[model samples]
Target: MKNSRGSLVRPHPLPGSASRPVVTPLSPSVVYASDTPDALDDQYEGRVFGYTYSREGHPNGDVVAARLDEMEGASGGIVTGSGMSAVSAVLLGLLKQGDHVLGGNQLYGRSLRMMAEDLPRLGIDTSLADPCDVDAMRAAIRPETKMILVEVVSNPTLRVADIAGIAALAKESGALLVIDNTFTTPRAFRPFDHGADIVIHSVTKLLAGHSDVMLGYAVARDPALNDRLRVFGVTAGLTASPFDCWLAERGMLSFDLRFDRSQETAARLADHLAGLDGVKRVLYPMRADHPDHARAVQLLGDQGCNMVSFELTGGRASANAFTKAADGLSFAPTLGDVGTTLSHPASSSHRALTPDRRAALGISEGFFRVSVGLEDPDALLQIMTDAVAAARAAEG
Candidate 1:
């Protein structure tokens, strides 16, 4: 018999059973013990399938990574602590000090800053170009350009890039084509199908469908590239927590249903708000008046995205009024919640950019981005109408 201290310190695991639970069990252990030194060595060398430490990898992360890889049609991938970390792993891991990166100017503000500002300090050069124009991107690429980063549909603005065109450009220049697919998940667009070398996602967004988890993933088409990213991710300590991975997996179970309903509602709201009073412009990829309408349809199909961006006639004051007077929607700095929410790009996402840069991207003080949720379509429309009226009154 063991002493009380020994018993307390090392409790025996429950008996193993053949029956499996319907849901994937969450294994939160930070370290795993191998039966033998040989077994441990095999795990470390990738000679066998297992894990030694959570930072290197955990079971949950692997499961989620595999799921995302399958969804994106990738051979393999890695999940990271956050979306930015995933992007960081790719850029920092692949590029040398003197390498250049050609990126889209209208990516999420943080991503834009990372490429345009942060990478430059590290001896890496970057150039931002129009995402929707292949010729503009081609003109920006240099001989040293090692990576071409872009998004299918830009954030806060509904500009759609010609992925196939940019992919061809990357191939010609011997640069890796990396795409951020957060705005249009695999449900709407699969970057890999269009020749993307790497596809990234902010899993905190629509992938998780809840405002709860902050996770991200990068899927690589090539197994060798995936291996490099995994090494970098492990070394940089960018591995995701087990609980977040579990939550993301659970959220994705109902992703299709939530995505369809919310997408439908977003389409309804964007169309209705286009001609409404106090609205200067509505930017929905599916809208005929949108600049990328044709390309968006060709790439994203008729489904469109759950996000809607619009400009208020009164600028900042009208935006503030609209948020204040809006019913059933709250002003949030983040998005991808089951509940509808609004984001002010000028103050929140793109506040770091200079006024000139922000203006160049068409992000005015009056610009508003909405993440339509699983709400009644008729009720949401009425709420939007009433809010617009209230905003106009406040502006007047």
Candidate 2:
């Protein structure tokens, strides 16, 4: 078979399979049979004869990782049980007791929590800096800092960081630059292009497109790091299920189409929301008034993924009213779904943080993060506008 570019491609088949079939969704197996003692020995030694056990390795996960590697321009990649697992594995695999990590203050709530609480328990120190402030990040770095971790586009707030600048700093500091590329998938931005040493993704989100599967991926620009991550994943039992890997691969097929549609809708909605009466602030990187607009254009170009965050003037009351009035839009805590959804940071993603911390991050009860879907932009805008008006009216 040949791809659209007319390059010859061979079918991916399982090693132990008798049939040379084109369409192969390799069955999930706990253990694979070894024909000979030599083959078993090779499997035990990690000689790559094929998967010996599902926990160590599997065909479905390998296929998905290979594809992610190709997309992200990574040397190697591994699939994990969840996004947090991918983050934890990479940190655990690379850093030791004395190592330090510099992370973005605006990271996902769970990530921040892990950095603040979990890494310290492992005897690793962490410092959180404003991702938008390169100087602050530089100042925060210590001699023991082994990794600089940040999201390509921050969660909830949608703040765009300077990946290239951070990468340069990390290189000079002898630290690895690790980016959570979950927001802008490889379709929109390849972290390697900006000198990221490692790229992480929550395949549960955009790559899966549909909200059905939970998977994570870590793609390494260095082969050694990749090997370390894989070993850590296998040893720690962080492997994703074969069925989820298979489903993720299938979802990746239409990722480009889904991404483009949702991104376009989000851009339009950001503009609409900016002018809406009840909206106090709109934070979309593509918007000219956004603080990181220039950086976003430099890094992501016009491809701003499906996220637009806005605040209501009436605080929590208006937000509650707006969500209640939004007929078709679901108030989902998650993002990257095909259907339009809204997430409340104060009550969901950022809920883990204290009220003071949430205030410090500019996340309030009025703030709402919208994950624009593949729905028609015009119709979605109308529904959103009506919802806002109703919310304001209710406040009056």
Candidate 3:
């Protein structure tokens, strides 16, 4: 069962059956009633029994994991209960006591807190550097640093990191490069192409597309690392439910179509926002004026993601007015949904950070995060424009 490319292809009856319903049920356990005692023993020992336990592995979870591994160009991968759990599994499974981790200052708020607060309590030290600055990242690395954690695109501001350069630096220093590829899905950017050792994704976002499933994944370039992560997942009971895995897989089937449409709309919206009167700044990698525009083109080519963040001239007052008056857009603290939505970082994702820390990351009281969706671009723009006008009137 090998493809023309010499890659082993999973057999067609698909391992789980091709004729069955698309939505697989929650298989708590499977009993091989037809098998003899000797056959059962062999099956269990070979890990082919399908379902001895739900936490260790299941057919639905296996299918999704294989698909994700293939998509991310990784040796293997595991699904976790939530995106943060996937992040935790990788950090905890790989690092030991006394190990140091260098992380990016632009990481999602919860991720930053985990590295700064949680790791320190476990005797593992951590430091944060601006990943956009390769020199700053290199200067922060120490001999004890076993891993360097960074998001492919910084949240809120959408700062792009130089993956290939950072990967080379990590290899030279004998450190693993772990990238959180949640913002940019595998369709747009595959970290492994740039020599990343590990890539993480929050399936709750663009992968799931609807924001209904809470799931995360860790894909490892090294098979040994993949095994370690799987073991950690089982031991910690962080494995995502089979039902959620199935839902995520279903959502992922349309990822290419959804992302393409949403991204097109996002690019149009970015340009429109930049021209609006109340908008102080528009932060999107595809925008020519973005600080990382060149790096983004180098790493992501023409595929800019659906996220757009902009600052309002009237601060929090304008932000509040715009969100409150905006029609056809919902106010959700999450991103990557089928319908466009907005989030206020000062109160949601980055709220845990101190005001000064938020300011340092360029997350102002007026900053607004837009998760573009599969909608008519012209209609979305009109709604946004009207909202801005309302916001400006409120400021007056």
Candidate 4:
């Protein structure tokens, strides 16, 4: 369940957690798990560029950041309280108020809003366009375009942006290409290898695998850029809890293995849903019909990530009924959990935008976002199939 307070993670059996002593919330020092060494050789030692505070760095957070940097093949990395914080901190760190951000039009609702609503208030200028539209991206560049931002795979719509193409444009224009890798976590897509200057993640979803934590990260292939972002991360006070970072660390170990299964299941579900009636469009990576399917395959390779989004033939009413029929699925927003979760883009994640603005961005009322999970695919298909049937029955 999710309220404004954020998501409530469903509990499952956590791995390697037997005989682990728990820390009471009563102390300045807290330990979430055992088998890990204490963070500081001298907790009070005054170290430079090292963990001076939890807001700056924590043992678990540094460990997790190191692991993610290795996984993504980044020279450096920083973790944040949430995914938005990661993007915000990096942008604020790299660009001043007058700097411009060229962002994808089909970004996650909040991400797009950050460009349209928040950044402007900071006296920053931004332009939204299809990052895959190479020519537009080229033409939109100004002397002030500091960052060209895109998601490896977009939310709800599953629109695959051409990471390499955008990267090329960014370089040609002397701007940095920032890729949001939440959907294509390091387990699947390594953006830095594709010329991305920076890679960001909403670790709360996939990286934290079990969905028990809220965290975000920004990784840089260049140490200089990483240092700049790190300073902003610290000064801005955007930091993940040490315990949450520890949870994310444990989640990191099984990333490649977990995402492999999840992506396979997602493709299966997409195929099943695509074949069924009352379906308007199926938006999974590598589909011939998708706008950027081929490019996605070329850049993202065989691991298409775990998201599968499609549209209902009957529009909003059908979309609503389908979601309602998915009773066992986690229907409240956020994705990247161990179990299957579904959402309606227009009404939920993108509700902050005006109807016309959402429609302008291709977020129709019929759009549905599904995140595949560690479940029996056949059972998952049945549940979704039933949702389609309910939508059809409601249409009648």
The most accurate candidate by TM-score is: 1
Provide TM-scores for the models: 0.97, 0.93, 0.92, 0.87
What ordering of candidates by TM-score runs from best to worst?
Answer: 1, 2, 3, 4
lDDT of all predictions, in order shown? Answer: 0.90, 0.89, 0.89, 0.81
User: Candidate 4 on 1-396: residue-level lDDT in tens?
Assistant: 556444446343346755755532222243332222344534434432344456667777777788888888875699898998998887888888899999988887788888888889999999988776778777778898989989877776777776777888889888888888888877777787788888998999887889898899998778899889988998888977878887787787787778889999998998899888888889888677778878887877787788998878787778778888886898868788889988787878889888898787677887788888899989999999999988877776
Cα lDDT tens digits, model 1, 83-104, are: 9999999999888899999999
User: What pairs collide in candidate 3?
Assistant: none
lDDT of 4: 0.81
Ranking by lDDT: 1, 2, 3, 4
- The reply for model 1, stretches above 4 Å from the true place, is 1-8
Tens-digit per-residue lDDT, 196-310, candidate 2: 8899999999889788889999978878889899999999999899999988888898988999989988989999999999889999998989989999999888887899999
- Model 2 CA RMSD to the hidden true structure, in angstroms: 7.2
How many backbone clashes does every candidate have? 0, 0, 0, 0
RMSD in angstroms between candidate 4 and the native structure over all alpha carbons: 8.9
Best by lDDT: 1
Q: Which is the winner by TM-score between candidate 2 and candidate 4?
A: 2
